[model samples]
Target: MRCAQFRTALSARLDGEPSGLPEVRLDKHVARCTGCRDWLARAQRLRAQVRTGTADGPSPEWSARLLVRLGEDRTGEQPPGPR
Candidate 1:
């Protein structure tokens, strides 16, 4: 399989959906291709983050900025709403 095909299959596999025989081909390609292997590692990390729910929460800076914006809005600027 080509790099593009492998990447598409890899994405599908990460989502846990059936990707048919193409996925096997992509997996084989990844075993032999360093770039594809690195991509797979990244995909696995992101997948783990999604599956384990570790990516669900917001960052501290987001809340801090929100509070600052809220304070500004209360002082008659604009609401602390999303852009």
Candidate 2:
């Protein structure tokens, strides 16, 4: 399978869904593909953080910034700050 298919399967597998690839093949792919290996490592770290309640949460400051940006998007009026 290509890298994109492998990534989609990896996500499903992580979520305990049925990934089409068997475990052995998945391991082989992960072992050989440096990009996939790095992606898997990051996904594992993010999963760990979420499981342990250590995942980064958006702070109030960021949330307000997002709201402002979204408002600009809806109204076609740019906020008086950096784009």
Q: Write down the worst ten-residue block by lDDT for model 1.
A: 72-81
Candidate 1 residue-wise lDDT at 83: 70
lDDT of 1 at 25: 71
lDDT of 1 by residue, 15-78 (tens): 7876655656766788999998999898888788988888767787787687676665334566
Report the lDDT tens digits of candidate 2 across residue range 1-79: 6898898889999999998888888889999999999999999999999999899999877877787867654356777
State the C-alpha lDDT per candidate. Answer: 0.75, 0.87
Model 2 CA deviation exceeding 4 Å by range: 60-83
Best by lDDT: 2
lDDT of 2 at 77: 76
RMSD of each: 5.5, 6.2
**What are the clash counts of all predictions, listed in order?**
0, 0
